[model samples]
Target: MSPLPEVPAAAGVYPITVRWSDMDAYRHVNNVQYLRLFEEARVYAFKDWFGADRDLIDEGLLVVSQAIDYLVPMEFAYAPARVAIWCSGTGAASFDLGYAVAGPEGDDTVYARGRVTLVAYDLLEQRPRRLGEAEREVLGTVRGEPPALRGDRSAAGSRGHR
Candidate 1:
């Protein structure tokens, strides 16, 4: 199969304040905390797409894969850091997201990169489902580049295989 195209820029950016709870014994942001930050940004961006649906999975979106790259260690700061995320590739049953975390405004340095694949699924049937036209259109607004163009550094040794 051919490779997917990459999104030229982040579709949306979310501000994240570093908290004491996010730091590790090394006095730097914990590795796991990066994933949490990505989730925060992704969830916030998707709220519009999810609409009034309290149960997000009611529409069948489920995270099937994830990858992240840590570029620099970080510490707590008063200013809010920015997490930029965007949709890229879309398939019959899934779509991909790309993300980057940057330092506070002005400084605005990127410190991490991430990607995830979300698949439509049938909870009752316990199986994957295809992306519908409405779902594709909603994702199309921010969709463009695939993360592989940035090196495809997904999470290493994740709990589940892709």
Candidate 2:
């Protein structure tokens, strides 16, 4: 398969362990497991981006939407998979994060591309909440272009991948 587009310079790269159970009978990582890998990366990224003292999960961030495009099948390996993530878009109450699952930095074999839209929420108030200035500022540091996934009509004039 052709190598995926280069990951943005501002993106955060997190190495995610691929569990043996993550593989399917097809001998490749299951499509659904990609989401888990993304989640693992986010957890590590948030801590580093927002600082360990700040707990965004406890403060409330909810996944409103998610999408992924499988570009190549990946088999389980001893080395952890590298997931590069960045802020793609931002709003008052929500933001979009782009993800690329691939091999180590020098390796260009991207297995998948994905995006997740998350909303700032108030668990105590049981309602969506606006993002704080501090949160927005943090997001700005990691801002980059969205993943050019298949079926993503929002990506320029080019038709999405089949």
TM-scores for every predicted model: 0.79, 0.90
Lowest summed-lDDT stretch of 10 residues in model 1?
A: 1-10
Candidate 2's displacement at residue 129, Å, is 0.1
| Residue 64 shift from truth in candidate 2, angstroms | 0.7
lDDT of 1 by residue, 1-162 (tens): 111122245367778777888889999889888888888877788886656664355556788877777878877788877887788778899888888777777655667878888888888898998877877787888775654423433433444223
* Cα lDDT for residue 76, candidate 1: 79
User: What lDDT does the true structure give each of the candidates?
Assistant: 0.72, 0.88
Maximum-lDDT candidate: 2
Instruction: Give me the runs in candidate 2 sitting further than 4 Å from their true place.
Output: 1-5, 154-162
Which consecutive 10 residues in model 2 have the weakest lDDT in total?
Answer: 153-162
Candidate 2 lDDT for residue 7: 79
Q: Compared with the true structure, what per-residue lDDT tens digits does model 2 show for residues 23-84?
A: 99999999999999999999999998999999898899899999999999999888888999
Q: Give the Cα-based TM-score of candidate 1 against the true structure.
A: 0.79
